[model samples]
Target: MRCETRLYNALNDRMRRSHGVAASQYEFLRYLRDHPDTRVGDLAAFFAIGVGATSKGMDRLEGRGLVRRVPDPADRRSSLLELTDTGTQLVHEADETFGAIGALIQTALDPARLHDAAQTLRQLLTALEHDRIGTPAG
Candidate 1:
Protein backbone atom coordinates (compact mmCIF):
# COMPACT_ATOMS: atom_id res chain seq x y z
CA MET A 1 0.00 0.00 0.00
CA ARG A 2 2.79 2.38 0.84
CA CYS A 3 4.55 1.60 -2.40
CA GLU A 4 1.41 2.16 -4.44
CA THR A 5 0.68 5.42 -2.64
CA ARG A 6 4.21 6.66 -3.17
CA LEU A 7 4.15 5.79 -6.86
CA TYR A 8 0.80 7.53 -7.32
CA ASN A 9 2.01 10.61 -5.46
CA ALA A 10 5.16 10.77 -7.55
CA LEU A 11 3.27 10.34 -10.79
CA ASN A 12 0.73 13.00 -9.83
CA ASP A 13 3.42 15.45 -8.77
CA ARG A 14 5.35 14.94 -11.98
CA MET A 15 2.30 15.19 -14.19
CA ARG A 16 1.01 18.37 -12.55
CA ARG A 17 4.37 20.08 -12.69
CA SER A 18 5.22 19.02 -16.22
CA HIS A 19 1.88 18.97 -18.02
CA GLY A 20 -0.62 20.66 -15.73
CA VAL A 21 -2.77 17.51 -15.87
CA ALA A 22 -3.69 14.87 -13.37
CA ALA A 23 -3.51 11.15 -14.22
CA SER A 24 -7.30 10.81 -14.19
CA GLN A 25 -7.67 13.82 -16.48
CA TYR A 26 -5.06 12.36 -18.79
CA GLU A 27 -6.99 9.08 -18.76
CA PHE A 28 -10.20 10.91 -19.69
CA LEU A 29 -8.47 12.60 -22.61
CA ARG A 30 -6.98 9.31 -23.75
CA TYR A 31 -10.40 7.66 -23.71
CA LEU A 32 -11.84 10.48 -25.80
CA ARG A 33 -8.94 10.23 -28.20
CA ASP A 34 -9.50 6.52 -28.63
CA HIS A 35 -13.30 6.70 -28.86
CA PRO A 36 -13.95 9.82 -30.85
CA ASP A 37 -17.72 9.62 -30.57
CA THR A 38 -18.04 8.38 -27.00
CA ARG A 39 -21.07 9.45 -24.98
CA VAL A 40 -20.63 11.21 -21.62
CA GLY A 41 -22.53 8.52 -19.75
CA ASP A 42 -20.37 5.83 -21.28
CA LEU A 43 -17.27 7.70 -20.21
CA ALA A 44 -18.54 8.06 -16.65
CA ALA A 45 -19.20 4.33 -16.42
CA PHE A 46 -15.86 3.47 -18.00
CA PHE A 47 -14.01 5.66 -15.55
CA ALA A 48 -16.03 4.28 -12.64
CA ILE A 49 -16.63 7.84 -11.50
CA GLY A 50 -19.83 9.72 -10.85
CA VAL A 51 -21.55 11.52 -13.74
CA GLY A 52 -21.08 14.87 -12.04
CA ALA A 53 -17.32 14.44 -11.75
CA THR A 54 -17.05 13.31 -15.35
CA SER A 55 -19.14 16.28 -16.50
CA LYS A 56 -16.90 18.65 -14.58
CA GLY A 57 -13.81 17.17 -16.24
CA MET A 58 -15.45 17.49 -19.62
CA ASP A 59 -16.16 21.13 -18.92
CA ARG A 60 -12.54 21.72 -17.93
CA LEU A 61 -11.27 19.97 -21.03
CA GLU A 62 -13.64 22.02 -23.20
CA GLY A 63 -12.60 25.23 -21.47
CA ARG A 64 -8.98 24.41 -22.34
CA GLY A 65 -9.97 23.91 -25.99
CA LEU A 66 -8.84 20.30 -25.78
CA VAL A 67 -12.24 18.69 -26.18
CA ARG A 68 -15.47 19.61 -27.94
CA ARG A 69 -18.92 18.46 -26.94
CA VAL A 70 -21.37 17.80 -29.74
CA PRO A 71 -24.97 16.74 -29.32
CA ASP A 72 -25.70 13.23 -30.42
CA PRO A 73 -27.73 13.04 -33.59
CA ALA A 74 -29.86 10.19 -32.29
CA ASP A 75 -30.33 11.68 -28.87
CA ARG A 76 -30.39 15.44 -28.73
CA ARG A 77 -29.93 15.62 -24.99
CA SER A 78 -26.87 13.36 -24.92
CA SER A 79 -23.47 14.66 -26.04
CA LEU A 80 -20.48 12.96 -27.69
CA LEU A 81 -16.90 13.91 -26.94
CA GLU A 82 -14.14 14.43 -29.47
CA LEU A 83 -10.60 15.60 -29.09
CA THR A 84 -9.33 18.70 -30.83
CA ASP A 85 -5.93 19.14 -32.51
CA THR A 86 -4.50 20.69 -29.36
CA GLY A 87 -5.76 17.75 -27.35
CA THR A 88 -4.05 15.35 -29.71
CA GLN A 89 -0.80 17.20 -29.23
CA LEU A 90 -1.21 17.15 -25.46
CA VAL A 91 -1.88 13.43 -25.50
CA HIS A 92 1.26 12.81 -27.49
CA GLU A 93 3.23 14.92 -25.04
CA ALA A 94 1.77 12.99 -22.13
CA ASP A 95 2.73 9.72 -23.77
CA GLU A 96 6.26 10.92 -24.24
CA THR A 97 6.41 12.07 -20.63
CA PHE A 98 5.29 8.65 -19.41
CA GLY A 99 7.69 6.91 -21.76
CA ALA A 100 10.56 8.91 -20.36
CA ILE A 101 9.56 7.97 -16.86
CA GLY A 102 9.49 4.32 -17.85
CA ALA A 103 12.93 4.57 -19.39
CA LEU A 104 14.30 6.19 -16.24
CA ILE A 105 12.89 3.43 -14.09
CA GLN A 106 14.25 0.77 -16.41
CA THR A 107 17.69 2.29 -16.09
CA ALA A 108 17.45 2.54 -12.30
CA LEU A 109 15.99 -0.89 -11.53
CA ASP A 110 16.75 -4.46 -12.41
CA PRO A 111 14.82 -5.51 -15.49
CA ALA A 112 13.56 -8.81 -14.06
CA ARG A 113 12.46 -7.23 -10.78
CA LEU A 114 10.64 -4.43 -12.58
CA HIS A 115 8.79 -6.89 -14.77
CA ASP A 116 7.77 -9.00 -11.79
CA ALA A 117 6.64 -5.89 -9.88
CA ALA A 118 4.53 -4.71 -12.82
CA GLN A 119 2.87 -8.12 -13.11
CA THR A 120 2.15 -8.17 -9.40
CA LEU A 121 0.63 -4.71 -9.55
CA ARG A 122 -1.54 -5.71 -12.50
CA GLN A 123 -2.84 -8.75 -10.63
CA LEU A 124 -3.60 -6.61 -7.58
CA LEU A 125 -5.55 -4.15 -9.70
CA THR A 126 -7.54 -6.95 -11.29
CA ALA A 127 -8.37 -8.49 -7.94
CA LEU A 128 -9.40 -5.09 -6.60
CA GLU A 129 -11.72 -4.42 -9.53
CA HIS A 130 -13.27 -7.85 -9.11
CA ASP A 131 -13.90 -7.10 -5.46
CA ARG A 132 -15.34 -3.72 -6.40
CA ILE A 133 -17.89 -5.36 -8.67
CA GLY A 134 -18.67 -8.05 -6.12
CA THR A 135 -17.42 -10.82 -8.36
CA PRO A 136 -15.93 -13.98 -6.91
CA ALA A 137 -12.46 -14.68 -8.22
CA GLY A 138 -11.84 -18.26 -9.24
Candidate 2:
Protein backbone atom coordinates (compact mmCIF):
# COMPACT_ATOMS: atom_id res chain seq x y z
CA MET A 1 0.00 0.00 0.00
CA ARG A 2 2.81 2.41 0.75
CA CYS A 3 4.51 1.76 -2.57
CA GLU A 4 1.21 2.01 -4.43
CA THR A 5 0.39 5.30 -2.76
CA ARG A 6 3.81 6.74 -3.47
CA LEU A 7 3.69 5.68 -7.10
CA TYR A 8 0.21 7.09 -7.52
CA ASN A 9 1.12 10.42 -5.97
CA ALA A 10 4.28 10.78 -8.01
CA LEU A 11 2.61 9.81 -11.26
CA ASN A 12 -0.43 11.97 -10.64
CA ASP A 13 1.69 14.96 -9.67
CA ARG A 14 3.80 14.64 -12.81
CA MET A 15 0.79 14.16 -15.07
CA ARG A 16 -1.01 17.17 -13.59
CA ARG A 17 2.09 19.35 -13.74
CA SER A 18 2.85 18.39 -17.34
CA HIS A 19 -0.67 18.07 -18.79
CA GLY A 20 -3.13 19.75 -16.44
CA VAL A 21 -4.74 16.43 -15.59
CA ALA A 22 -4.73 14.18 -12.56
CA ALA A 23 -4.16 10.48 -12.82
CA SER A 24 -7.74 9.60 -11.96
CA GLN A 25 -9.16 12.08 -14.45
CA TYR A 26 -6.76 10.81 -17.09
CA GLU A 27 -8.04 7.28 -16.54
CA PHE A 28 -11.61 8.49 -16.95
CA LEU A 29 -10.75 10.43 -20.08
CA ARG A 30 -8.91 7.52 -21.64
CA TYR A 31 -11.90 5.29 -21.02
CA LEU A 32 -14.25 7.80 -22.62
CA ARG A 33 -11.92 8.16 -25.57
CA ASP A 34 -12.08 4.42 -26.19
CA HIS A 35 -15.73 3.99 -25.32
CA PRO A 36 -17.52 6.90 -26.91
CA ASP A 37 -21.19 7.41 -26.02
CA THR A 38 -20.83 5.45 -22.79
CA ARG A 39 -23.30 6.24 -20.05
CA VAL A 40 -22.22 7.69 -16.72
CA GLY A 41 -23.78 4.73 -14.91
CA ASP A 42 -21.86 2.31 -17.10
CA LEU A 43 -18.63 4.14 -16.38
CA ALA A 44 -19.38 4.08 -12.67
CA ALA A 45 -19.96 0.37 -12.79
CA PHE A 46 -16.77 -0.19 -14.72
CA PHE A 47 -14.73 1.84 -12.29
CA ALA A 48 -16.57 0.62 -9.19
CA ILE A 49 -17.41 4.20 -8.20
CA GLY A 50 -20.69 5.85 -7.30
CA VAL A 51 -22.84 7.04 -10.21
CA GLY A 52 -23.38 10.40 -8.54
CA ALA A 53 -19.67 10.96 -8.11
CA THR A 54 -19.05 9.92 -11.69
CA SER A 55 -21.71 12.32 -12.92
CA LYS A 56 -20.18 15.14 -10.89
CA GLY A 57 -16.76 14.39 -12.32
CA MET A 58 -18.24 14.37 -15.79
CA ASP A 59 -19.77 17.76 -15.09
CA ARG A 60 -16.33 19.13 -14.32
CA LEU A 61 -14.92 17.72 -17.53
CA GLU A 62 -17.85 19.18 -19.47
CA GLY A 63 -17.31 22.56 -17.86
CA ARG A 64 -13.69 22.41 -18.97
CA GLY A 65 -14.81 21.71 -22.58
CA LEU A 66 -13.04 18.37 -22.58
CA VAL A 67 -16.26 16.39 -22.73
CA ARG A 68 -19.90 16.81 -23.66
CA ARG A 69 -22.98 14.89 -22.70
CA VAL A 70 -25.72 14.11 -25.18
CA PRO A 71 -29.13 12.67 -24.57
CA ASP A 72 -29.25 8.96 -25.14
CA PRO A 73 -31.71 8.31 -27.93
CA ALA A 74 -32.71 4.93 -26.56
CA ASP A 75 -32.83 6.13 -22.98
CA ARG A 76 -34.01 9.67 -22.65
CA ARG A 77 -33.32 9.82 -18.93
CA SER A 78 -29.65 8.99 -19.28
CA SER A 79 -26.91 10.86 -21.08
CA LEU A 80 -24.08 9.47 -23.20
CA LEU A 81 -20.63 10.97 -22.94
CA GLU A 82 -18.16 11.80 -25.68
CA LEU A 83 -14.70 13.30 -25.54
CA THR A 84 -14.17 16.65 -27.23
CA ASP A 85 -11.37 17.23 -29.70
CA THR A 86 -9.30 18.79 -26.94
CA GLY A 87 -9.83 15.76 -24.73
CA THR A 88 -8.75 13.44 -27.52
CA GLN A 89 -5.64 15.47 -28.11
CA LEU A 90 -4.78 15.50 -24.44
CA VAL A 91 -5.12 11.74 -24.22
CA HIS A 92 -2.76 11.37 -27.16
CA GLU A 93 -0.17 13.50 -25.46
CA ALA A 94 -0.70 11.82 -22.12
CA ASP A 95 0.23 8.54 -23.75
CA GLU A 96 3.67 9.92 -24.43
CA THR A 97 3.93 11.18 -20.88
CA PHE A 98 3.14 7.72 -19.56
CA GLY A 99 5.59 6.14 -21.95
CA ALA A 100 8.27 8.50 -20.78
CA ILE A 101 7.67 7.42 -17.21
CA GLY A 102 8.07 3.81 -18.27
CA ALA A 103 11.33 4.72 -19.98
CA LEU A 104 12.58 6.45 -16.85
CA ILE A 105 11.71 3.44 -14.73
CA GLN A 106 13.49 1.08 -17.10
CA THR A 107 16.57 3.24 -16.95
CA ALA A 108 16.58 3.18 -13.15
CA LEU A 109 15.70 -0.50 -12.81
CA ASP A 110 16.38 -3.61 -14.82
CA PRO A 111 13.95 -3.86 -17.72
CA ALA A 112 13.49 -7.60 -17.11
CA ARG A 113 12.58 -7.00 -13.46
CA LEU A 114 10.13 -4.29 -14.44
CA HIS A 115 8.47 -6.58 -16.98
CA ASP A 116 8.16 -9.33 -14.40
CA ALA A 117 6.68 -6.96 -11.87
CA ALA A 118 4.19 -5.64 -14.43
CA GLN A 119 3.19 -9.17 -15.38
CA THR A 120 2.72 -10.14 -11.75
CA LEU A 121 0.63 -7.04 -11.13
CA ARG A 122 -1.55 -7.89 -14.12
CA GLN A 123 -2.13 -11.38 -12.83
CA LEU A 124 -3.03 -10.09 -9.39
CA LEU A 125 -5.44 -7.54 -10.83
CA THR A 126 -7.11 -10.17 -12.99
CA ALA A 127 -7.60 -12.44 -10.05
CA LEU A 128 -8.93 -9.65 -7.89
CA GLU A 129 -11.46 -8.63 -10.52
CA HIS A 130 -12.44 -12.22 -11.14
CA ASP A 131 -13.08 -12.70 -7.45
CA ARG A 132 -15.39 -9.71 -7.43
CA ILE A 133 -17.44 -10.76 -10.43
CA GLY A 134 -20.46 -11.87 -8.44
CA THR A 135 -19.94 -9.50 -5.51
CA PRO A 136 -21.66 -6.22 -4.86
CA ALA A 137 -19.68 -3.07 -5.47
CA GLY A 138 -19.41 -0.42 -2.82
Query: How displaced is residue 134 in candidate 1, in Å?
Result: 8.4
Q: Work out the TM-score per prediction.
A: 0.78, 0.86
Report the error of model 2 at residue 94, Å. 1.9
Clash count list over all predictions: 0, 0
lDDT by residue for model 2 (2-115), tens: 977877787798889999988888889999999978998888878878888888999998999999999999989978999999999998999887777677678877978988
Colliding residue pairs in candidate 1: none
TM-score computed on alpha carbons, candidate 1: 0.78
Candidate 1 lDDT over 45-116, as tens digits, reads 776677777889999989999999988998898888999999888888888766766786788779999999
Please list the C-alpha lDDT of all candidates, in the order they appear. 0.81, 0.86
Model 2 — TM-score against the truth?
A: 0.86
- The local distance difference test score of model 2 is 0.86
In model 1, how large is the Cα lDDT of residue 58?
A: 91
